[model samples]
Target: MNTPDVAGATGYIDTNFKGKAEKAIQELNDGCDFVYIHFEAPDECGHRRETQNKIRSIELIDELVLPVVIEGLEKFVDYKIMILPDHPTPIKTATHASDAVPYVIYHKNAEIVSGIDSIDEESAKSTNNYVNFGPDIMKKFLGA
Candidate 1:
């Protein structure tokens, strides 16, 4: 059997954000110019009846996954990290939302002091670090 070079992958099991973080670092090791890590738990939680799961999922992503991925990326060169949801999933409705969702863009060279400790809707809005360019955001980030 051939071992996959990428990480965060398994068969017949639930996907975890930790795997996504591992895969991202592995991709960076494999000389990838860019890496994309996806987490499904929040959406899954939103689909369920419990609201705590959704909150916990987001917390895990922010506290656990973010630090791991960021620390791994720090080994190479500075990077611009952008975290955003495709759309809002209101736990109240337990459904998908088509409305605009807030995103956070942390430029590697940008100053991070100014009372900025985390990246979320409020922090993103207050810092003016939003990515609303849709699909073009990636291209623009890559200078394409």
Candidate 2:
């Protein structure tokens, strides 16, 4: 898929990306055990140097994806869901910073972890902050 220019040069956010996200979520609901989706619309908006687009993307996730995806998973009564970004690209720099992105994961049997506010401390101990430690974290979650 061609990435749309989020700047005024394009003037409009393409709707296909979100539509595809919806479809994929639906398909996963049919049979897949897990689904991992990444849409860079927010990152693209940031690259365009606007938080407004990022905010809009966030709202779309809240309004569209969350309800559909979560409701689908909840139906199984044994599924888990995790949502987070790998890293955030700053609007001003339009570049990915080596900063940690907030991450979260859940399993039907896993207790909800609370009060672990920031990834900063965990990231500081690692080589790349903001770089994903998702696989490692996932392994642990599955093992539990």
Candidate 3:
């Protein structure tokens, strides 16, 4: 709900949004089935006109925001946690290149026999067919 500009006084990569997300997760803890926090700081940073700032932003996310989010989510949620970027943003290009980003998912209940346990291109390719979004994911879950 509190979506802050990544480039504003409070950096987009700040824990402000993450705190909001955590609060939202807590608020919905009783009844909600799912939640999604799509922070666009990384994307914005990737497209920055300047090079150093972009790299710094990436480092900030990787160093500060990411660990906190992951740790906080794990503390709050009881089950699986999946971390996947829609695409990759190259540092050199300072732009989002059409490249498959890394994907990793941690499931608490079931052992991960396949899919993105580790971040490798070959592994992603291997499990691409098995993983789909929305209705497909639901179908897969329900054995439909």
Cα RMSD to the true fold for all candidates: 4.2, 6.3, 5.2
Look at candidate 3 and tell me the lDDT of residue 78.
Answer: 52
lDDT of 1 by residue, 1-144 (tens): 223344444321245667678777877788776777656777777777458877877887877688888888788656777777777677888898775566656667663555677655676567664456578777755652
Better model by lDDT: candidate 1 vs candidate 2: 1
CA error at residue 57 for candidate 2, angstroms: 0.9
The digit string of per-residue lDDT tens for model 3 on 55-129 reads 565566566556655665565535555555555666568777766554555556564565345555567777664
Mind giving the per-residue lDDT tens digits that candidate 2 earns over 1-144? 333232222223444444545665666666655556666677788788878887787677667667776666666757666667666788889877776566555677666655555444364445342335546766654564
The stretch of ten residues in a row with the least summed lDDT in candidate 3 is 2-11
List ranges where model 1 is wrong by over 4 Å.
1-14, 110-117, 123-133
Which runs of model 3 end up more than 4 angstroms from their true locations? 1-11, 15-17, 49-78, 113-144
Candidate structures ordered by TM-score, highest first: 1, 2, 3
Comparing 1 with 2 on TM-score, the higher-scoring candidate is 1
Q: How accurate is candidate 2 locally (lDDT)?
A: 0.61
